[model samples]
Target: MTFTLGPKATSAGYKLAAFDQIGSTNAEAMVRARDGESGPTWFATTEQTAGRGRRQRAWVAPRGNLASSILEVMDVSPAVAATLGFAAGLSLESALQKLSIEANMRRAGTEPLQFALKWPNDVLAERQKLAGILLEAEAVAGNRLAVVVGIGTNVVAAPEGTPTPATSLAALGVQVGAEELFKALAEAWVEFRGIWDNGRGFGEIRKLWLERAFGVGERVAIQTGTTKVEGTFDTIDDTGCLIVRTADGRRMPITAGEVYFGTAASVGAA
Candidate 1:
């Protein structure tokens, strides 16, 4: 399982440890990061046996697709830590562009295939899902940090039991190799980290992210714990909270929840 990228095959200061099979690349990277393994290290597997998504949902990854996780050391606060999800989305958008997926920031007042960011993570190609991200953080020695960001993108095949209409890069007529996509994502993350480090924080990334946002200003639904809120999508704050404007005109900041959007009649709620 060799992972190489482009013509020059530039390594992004991260060691790639590819597995023919593993339970989860994130889980494996977590183990390595906690045991004094210096990161940013990447773990990619051809077949992930027990891949998990947000909320413990099973991520069905076949052998030929991209299943990878990256572990890095950071000194940011928890608030900044939360914004890594958007950073992941932006980085994936870069990788998608490299793969020729037509994943770009749509202009204002333009209606393309609305590929948006759902809350913290998850890139949507139209209303259907195209990619997912999961960020896990652990305390290291003396205020230092280790965070493993897992990314699962459908390059060749999508699982059957997904509730929404899902698509793959190949399905969208973009045939990309797994190794090439991984390298592109690593390079993209390098640029994303720069945005976070320059103290402009996620503001720049948020602006670019919003341009690609699909359901902003539309009627949407969200579920947090036992509470379900229906409201109009508003803006994203610096820390990546989805601001929902209720019917009564109150702006609610949602920290964590499942989000959905559609027409007023068929607004899908997960």
Candidate 2:
């Protein structure tokens, strides 16, 4: 009924603040961060009335979904802190594998489900999005900034109408709960933090991420700025940029874009 730090998290000095409902956990974390709250803490809620994701997409969490934000005062710059997206993605994937589905019953006629990482912070199960991660940074005192990592996972039910195909653990015949997922995520964060090592170990992070990445060699379309580019989903660069190989054999390194796997009509949310 309450959020408490696991053994690893507690040893790492992490804390959790649980709420029954909130406008947005990230908003609350940012507000406190702006007020000089440099916390290695987490702001979690049972429900969110005004949850938002990347590009300000409205996130709908119907009670059983997991909606939480982890705020950390980093010594790195805003640009460096942006790499938390990758860390968060890897962490979420680990958490899901740790406690994703129930084996007693199967949904979608699948026995054991799997979770994979999509570029730019989305986690997928059998190619459908099961969770997403959003990273934001707010300048605090001096050169340091407070990085807020927001995670939204579909638990009991997936969104009805979505740009991309959506899925939930329950839909996959997994009976995992939000609290269980959150706790696994908190511990997973601690486990991956050493590999991150404040970005010094990014090379390893990038390598591990690529191993669990989804849509590695699939045809994909990306909408960048006002231009749209279609190509094969090549490997992500060492710096975490999505590399797409066009028809002309030219490799394009995209830093920021909305990527959709498959056809033009398949251009969904990122």
Candidate 3:
């Protein structure tokens, strides 16, 4: 029940710290960054006492769920560092696939699930949220950026009473543990981060992301700041900005926002 860093992480020069319980792995990682811990590091925990999501929304990851954060020092600007969200999402997807969770679902007589990646950093199975990603960044000396990518996934139990429908691998009859998934995730992160090539390979990343995109060409509402715009989910541009077309035929490139996939995706990171 302990979290350990495998060769995939250590060989890649990534350090890891684990806790039985913590206020927030992302917060701890950021604290390390501020304390002169220039790292490609991971902070993981079994339970989160004060977790949070984008826009400061409360994020609850109970024991048996996978809650982890990565602190990466990058040579790029803050804007470019945000692109790590895309890599994180893809890494989660790849990890799940490597674990063969879907095959287990099929053995349980459930039809094959159509997994999709939502805008920003959410993963969906049958259009329901299976995982979420949150990215935060800060600047250091020499214009270097320290970005933290927080990933939370339901494994043994899914939270009830949420904005949108939530699901876990166990709900779909896949037997998995947080520690096992974390191992796969560590390796997967190495692969995806290499593919990202420090923001230079975004062209390839964007293409792969589009291949697994969810709700493309579908009507949705994206809230940025005080403005809530309804539009069709277009595609992520080369720079990782989401492209949306409004009712007025105006195209908007949203740098970041809360996307509502109509009524179904009202998910509060639930």
Candidate 4:
């Protein structure tokens, strides 16, 4: 099915650029931004040939999977722009939950899937990584900053033996297609983005995110380079840093790290 923006997104003046296959939707969006494409535009595909996730890790989406990115140019600080990723996470989670419910309705006695937003940028289903989000920003002329939020979901395929175990919508028995998910995502984005209000409404977003957050108040270990920090997942601060309450009663804010949970937290396993 051809990709198109939902009614809300279209009415909000958002545009879409759908692709059958692409090296990376994030890369395409950034390239467009460099070419003076000052947009609230979406670049999406079901087959991503060469995608990259956080920390430069490869995030290739095979055929039948979904890889998408949205670009926005705004006059905000980089710190403020970073919080936008939280909104992206919330948008996708909302979309997934809606579709999963609809899918479950068509079947008999099927348990509805549980979805949660992971710390920083991931969506978890049954505690397995179902989607990842990456945000990139660059300063442009006229003192405006161009930011791209990339979201990749396992619609029908997931790689084996990842650092964190991965799962797909098909594997979870949701029976959703990339086209349908993208349409829902576009609509959800419109709602959450309006609520986010370009970072001004992040307090509300933060509260909503924590309500659907995974691993909160649970043991978590974060590895930043050679250093490792272990503590309970306290909360995310105003700027979206992962707040870990250490054993010594210090709330340490982690800006970036590879996270591990439960028993894996002790070993700092990949």
lDDT tens readout by residue for model 1, 83-197 = 7778888888777765563332322443334456666678777566888899888888768677888999888887765656688876666656777788788788778867766
Those runs of model 3 whose alpha carbons end farther than 4 Å from true positions after fitting are 101-111, 262-270
Relative to the true structure, candidate 1 has a C-alpha RMSD (angstroms) of 4.3
Q: Which predicted model would earn the best TM-score?
A: 4
Error of 4 at 61 (Å): 0.8
Q: Could you tell me every candidate's TM-score relative to the true structure?
A: 0.88, 0.93, 0.91, 0.98
On residues 1-270, what C-alpha lDDT tens digit does candidate 4 reach at each position?
889888999999999999999999999999999999999999999999999999899999999999999999999999999999999999999999999999999997989899999988999999999999999999988999999999999999888989889999999999989999999999999999899888999999999999999999999999998888999999999889999999999999999999988988987634
Candidate 4 wrong stretches, greater than 4 Å? none
In the range 1-270, model 3's lDDT, one tens digit per residue, is 678777878898988898999999999999998888888888988788898987788888898898999999888877778787898889998888767654665477555556789988888877778888989999876678889999999887787876557899878666878988898899899988999988998888888889999888988777777777777888889889889898788888988777888654344212
Where does candidate 1 clash, by residue pair?
none
Better of 1 and 3 by TM-score: 3
Worst lDDT 10-window in candidate 3? 261-270
C-alpha RMSD for every candidate: 4.3, 2.5, 2.8, 1.0
Q: Residue 45 deviation, candidate 4, in Å?
A: 0.7
Better of 1 and 4 by lDDT: 4
Q: By TM-score, rank the candidates, best first.
A: 4, 2, 3, 1
Candidate 2 — what's its lDDT? 0.83
Error of 2 at 227 (Å): 0.5
Candidate 4, residue 91: the lDDT equals: 98
Q: What C-alpha lDDT, on a 0 to 100 scale, does residue 52 get in candidate 3? A: 90
**Whole-model lDDT per candidate:** 0.76, 0.83, 0.84, 0.94
